[model samples]
Target: QQQVKQSPQSLIVQKGGIPIINCAYENTAFDYFPWYQQFPGKGPALLIAIRPDVSEKKEGRFTISFNKSAKQFSLHIMDSQPGDSATYFCAASNSGYSTLTFGKGTMLLVSP
Candidate 1:
């Protein structure tokens, strides 16, 4: 199974602070990258993502920064709020089959 190493198993931030979660993978065949945000008692929802062709991508308050050379990527939640507290996951998959390998997960707590 492909593995994505994610840092900072957990994090805490004050309101309005940006919480960044980083992930690294060794596989180069992986082409599609995406981040998922899961709230308590709910399924994960796609946050933001970037392809190898793009250095970065942003959707609303969420941002994804990608580095093809390093085979790494990160997720940043801008202006984090208490309501934003949840578990974030980073995933990668090649175009073929769309099988995704996700990071263990990161628990984020945003304090008001």
Candidate 2:
């Protein structure tokens, strides 16, 4: 079973706009939720993360909203710029677990 489900296979936004990506997970054992951003020809890097204990987390222009009871999470990009265009992924993992399952991925395009 796919542990994570992400919505809006892709997105487009103008400069200064906000782009949102959503995700849902099926496994309650998932204790950690993280979002990754990847640019062309580069490896994906951790953008921000959240735990079941926190409802939300923010770092710079990226924010992660999590709902433990609903087993859902979403990422929002504030003041999106063309430079922010990239592929974003949502992932879930349990503490001490070696495996991290990721959502399909969302392609974000920020038009200048």
Candidate 3:
């Protein structure tokens, strides 16, 4: 059903800047929300994630904000660097399901 939708097909920012990527979902059945980062020619890797129980989560310079009621979430990359430039994807999965439905993807460029 393409439950997850992400905005900003592309983004550009300078080093040490913060890039915010937003996403919305339609399925209340989704219990897990994850954001992934992928470099060119590489597979996507989990960057950060949040569950409905938490309003937000943080790992290093990456953070995730989740709203259970609104079925929405977003990712923030703090102090972004050129190495952080990549394609980001937002995804959702049901509680009992292992498969994830992913958003189209947001390409981010961090300029040096």
**Total backbone collisions for each predicted model:** 0, 0, 0
Worst 10 residues of 3 by lDDT: 1-10
C-alpha RMSD of candidate 2: 1.0
Which segments of model 3 are wrong by more than 4 Å?
A: none
**What TM-score would each prediction reach against the true structure?**
0.96, 0.96, 0.96
**Deviating ranges (above 4 Å) for candidate 1:** none
Candidate 1 lDDT score relative to the true structure:
0.92
What is the per-residue lDDT of model 3 for residues 1-112, given as tens digits with 9 covering 90 to 100? Answer: 7478999889999999999999999988898899999999999999988989999999999999998888899999999999999999999999787899999999999999
> Residue 85 deviation, candidate 3, in Å?
0.6
User: How does candidate 3 score on lDDT?
Assistant: 0.94
TM-score of 1: 0.96
Report residue 56 deviation for candidate 2 (angstroms): 0.7
lDDT of 2 by residue, 13-80 (tens): 99999999999999899998999999999999999999999899999999999988889999999999
lDDT value, residue 30 of candidate 2: 90
Q: TM-score of the candidate numbered 3? A: 0.96
